[model samples]
Structures are given as structure tokens and as C-alpha cells.
Target chain A: EAGVTQSPRYAVLQEGQAVSFWCDPISGHDTLYWYQQPRDQGPQLLVYFRDEAVIDNSQLPSDRFSAVRPKGTNSTLKIQSAKQGDTATYLCASSFLGTKDTQYFGPGTRLLVL
Target chain B: QQQVRQSPQSLTVWEGETAILNCSYENSAFDYFPWYQQFPGEGPALLISILSVSDKKEDGRFTIFFNKREKKLSLHIADSQPGDSATYFCAAMTNSAGNKLTFGIGTRVLVRP
Candidate 1:
């Protein structure tokens, strides 16, 4: 089976610009997650959804970051106004709801904000 | 506050030697622990995991030894190979936390051939 896939493997933007990252999860997976991984740091959970319903988004920066999984199979993470601090890799992961402990990740979109 | 902590930001080992990575967490409620391996440009992939019920878990050359009482754990990579050179992250999650993972800073391992 194909693994999770992400679009626009890389992105470069100036401060205050907007960018969006898209993700297509593995087939038959019902749980999707978005994580932010800064250089030299571990992946931190930003948001997650289960079958079109958001399970948790407390870690997400509501002022500038937003994510949605409308149909539950695909997800999009958007940053309305990028800042230098937002320069990091955005990763999307998925897992079966029954086996949520084992998550598979995508290549991730590397964003650079100047 | 960083709930999860990893010791020795980096390590170097010979191909035939073993590489050990340590991890500790402050949350006593965390019941699931997973270790992830990541390459330079790729996202992390699950390597191994252990539940609070088990004190040890082994897969192939990788082993996880957990100490629930001390909230500490270690990942042992036996007979390390050059291909095993990558950043390893230790993560934890509670059974009631909706699968939210708390990850450590990660240890970058370099296996010399």
C-alpha cells in the first residue's frame, strides 16, 4: 500500500506571506495528524482529526495556523501570515483509528520564512 | 514546559557496536511509548514501542527497556550499521489523551563503517 503523501515538497516565503500545505493520507486510514518539526527538534503535534471531526487542535496557533480534513481522507494546513519563527517542516501522518498508536508519516513540506 | 527529555544530543558508534539512547518523561499518566527514526529530509517513522504493561520490548536489533517507576526508558540499537545513522525521537502518550504524542528533542546517531 502507498504511504502518506504530501504536496509541494518545499516552500519559501517572506514574512507575512501565506502558504498552504496539502496531505493525502494512506488508504482506509481514519485518523490524520499534523505536526510541526523545527530543525534539531522533534515533531510536535499541531492538530488532528478522525473521520472529518477534529479531535484536538489546542496546540495549533489559531491566529495564523489552520487545518481541515473535510472528507476525512485528505487534509490541508494553512498559515495565514508566516513569520520567521514559523520556518520549520510541516508533517502529516495517518493511522487506523483502531491502531492509532502506530502512525505513518509523509516526507513533509519544508517551509522557509525569511 | 518540555515534558519529554532525551539525553546526549548526539552519539557516534562503530558499525559493530551498540548505540544507546535515553529518554525520560515527567508525565506519569503516559502509558504508551514509541521510538521514531528519521532521516535528514524525511519524516519520522515508527521504530518500536512499548506499553506500560511491558518492561521490555525487542524487535530485531532494536530494544526498548522501560522503567515505569522512574519514568525512564532507553533504546538499544545492537550491532549498529551505517544505515542506522539517523535521528531518533522518543515519544509518549496517555491512553486518555486522544493520541497526542509528546516527543523528545531526539538523539542524532552516527554509525561509523
Candidate 2:
């Protein structure tokens, strides 16, 4: 089976610019998650969804970040007016169930905000 | 606060030697632990996992030794090979807490032939 897939494998933007990362989860998975991984660090959860409903998004920067899974099969994470601090790899993962199940991750979209 | 912590941010060992990565968690409720391995420029992949009820779990050359009372665990890679080099992250999660994982900074392992 195909693993989680993400678009724009790499993105470079100037400070204050906007970018959106897209994800297509596993075909039969019900849980999807977005994580940010800075250099030399572990992946940090930003938001997650079960089907088309968001389960947790406390880590997301409310003012500049937003995510949606309107159709329950795909997801989009958008960062508006990005800053240099937002430079990191954005990973998309999917699980058969929720976080209790094994999570398979996509290669990730590497973002560099200058 | 950091819920999970790992030791030896980086390590190197001969191909035939064994490499041990240590991790500890602060949340007593964390009942599931999983180790993920990531190569440069790639996403992490699940290496192995264990539940709280068990103190040990082994898969091929990888073994997890857990200590519930100590809230710690160690991942042991035996007969290491050069291709085994990667960053290993230790993560903990509790069924009660939405099963969201809390991960350690990660340990970078380099197996030299």
C-alpha cells in the first residue's frame, strides 16, 4: 500500500510570505496528523484529525497557522505571513486508527523562510 | 517541560559492536513507547514498539528493555552495520491523552565499518 503522501517536497519563502502544504493520507486510514521537525530535533505534533473532524490542534500557532480536512481523506496546512522561525520540515502522517496505532509518515515538505 | 528525554545525543560504534540508546519519560501515565529511525532528509519510520504490560520486546537485532518503575527504557542494536546509521527518536504516549506522542530530542547513531 502507498504510504502517506505530501506535496511540494521543498518550499522556500521570504519572511511574511504564505505557503500551504498538502497531504494525502493512506487510503483506509482514519487518522491524520501534521508535525514540524526542526533540524536535529524530533517531530513535534502541530495538529491532528480523525476523518473530517479535528481532534487536537493546540500546538498550532493560532494567529498564523490553519489546517483543514474538509473531505476526511486529504488535509491542508497553511502558514500565513511566515517567519524565519517557521523554517522547518513539515511532515504528514496517517494511522489506521488514532494515535494509538502505528503512524506512517510522508517524506515531508521542507520549508525555508528567509 | 520535556516529557521525554534521551541520552548520548550522538554515538559511534564499530560495525560488529552493539549500540545502546537510553530514554526516559516523565509522564507516569505513558503506557506505550515506540522508537523511530530517520535517515538524513527522510521522515522517521517506526523501528519497534512496546506496551507497558511487557518489560521487554525484541525484533531481530533490535531489543527494547523497559523499566516501568524507573520510567525509562533502552533500545539495543546488536551486531550493528554501517547502514544502521540514523537518528533514533524515543516517543511515549498514553491512551488517556488522545494517544498523542511526546518525543525525545533523538539520538544519532553511526555504525562504522
Candidate 3:
């Protein structure tokens, strides 16, 4: 089985620009997650969805960051106005609902805002 | 506030030696703990995990020793190899919290050949 896949392996933008990252989860996986990992730091959960319904998004910055899993298989994370502080790696992961603890991650999209 | 904490930001060990990574969390409600291994430019992959109900879990050469009372845990890599050189992150989650993971800063291990 193929693992989770992400698009645009890298992205570079200036402050106030907008960028979007896409993700395709593993087949038959119902739970999808988005995380932000800064350099030298661990990944921090930004949002998550289960079968098209958002389970948690409190960590997400509502003013600039948003994510959606419309069909439950694919997801998109968008930053309305990127900032220098937003320079980090955006990672997507998925797992079966029954085994939520074991999440598989993608290669991630490295974003740099100048 | 950082919910999870990892000690010794970096470590170096010989190929035949063991590498020990420590982690601790402040949340008492966290019931699940998972350790993730990440290479430079790649996302983290699940290495091993343990539930609060268990005190220890071992997989191959990796072992997780948990102390629920003290809210501390450690990952032991036996007979480390050069291929094991990577950043290891310790994450914690709660059953009631929608399985959202809170990760530590991570410990970068360098295994010398």
C-alpha cells in the first residue's frame, strides 16, 4: 500500500503572500491530520479530520491558517497571509479510525517565508 | 506551554553502543505515548508506542520504559547503527482529546560507524 503523499514538495513565498499545501492520505484511512514542524522542533498538531468532519482545530491559527478535508480522502492546508514566522514544514498524516495511535506521515512540504 | 519535554537535545554513540533518549510530559490525562523517528527532509515515522496501562514496551532493538507515576519515559536503542542516526520525537495524546499528539522538541541522535 502506498503511504501518504503531499504535493509541491517545497514552496517559497514572501510575507503577506498566500500558499496552499495539499495532501492525499493512504487508501481506506479515515483519519487525517495536519501538523506544523519548525526547524529543530517537533511537529505540532494544527488540525485533524475524521471522515470529512473536523475533530479538532483549536491549534490552528484561524486568522491565517485553515484546513479542509472535503471528501475525507484528501486535504488542503492554506495560509491566507504567510508570515516569516510561518516558515516551517507542513506535514500530513493518516491512520485508521480503529488504530488512531499509529499514524503514517508523508514527506511534508517545506515552506519558507521571507 | 510545552506539554512534552525531551532531555539532551543531541547525542552521539558508537555503532555497537546503546542510545538512550528520555521524555517527560506534564499532562496527567495523556494515555498514549508514541516515539517518532525523522530523517532530515522527511516527516516523522512512528517508531514505538506505549499506553499508560503498561510500564514497558519493546520492539526489536527499541524499547520504551514508562513511569506513569512520575510522568517520565525513555526510549532505548540497543546496538545502535549508523542508519539509526536521526531526530527522535516523543509524543503524547489522550483518548478524550481526539488523539491529537503533543510532541517534544526531539532528540537528535548521531550513531558513529
lDDT of 3 at B8: 88
Per-residue lDDT of candidate 1, residues A1-114 (tens digit): 999999899999999999999999999999999999999999999999998999999999999999999998999999999999999999999998763459999999999999
Cα shift from native, residue A43, model 3 (Å): 0.4
Q: Which residue pairs come into collision in candidate 3?
A: none
What tens digits encode model 1's per-residue C-alpha lDDT throughout B1-113?
A: 99999988999999999999999999999999999999999999999999989999999999999999999999999999999999999999997787799999999999999
Whole-model alpha-carbon lDDT for candidate 2: 0.94
User: Candidate 2 DockQ category?
Assistant: medium
- The weakest ten consecutive residues by lDDT in model 2 chain B span B94-103
Best by DockQ: 2
Ranking by DockQ: 2, 3, 1
lDDT for each candidate structure? 0.95, 0.94, 0.95
lDDT of 3 by residue, A1-114 (tens): 999999999999999999999999999999999999999999999999998999889989999999999888899999999999999999999999764458999999999999
Candidate 2 collision pairs = none
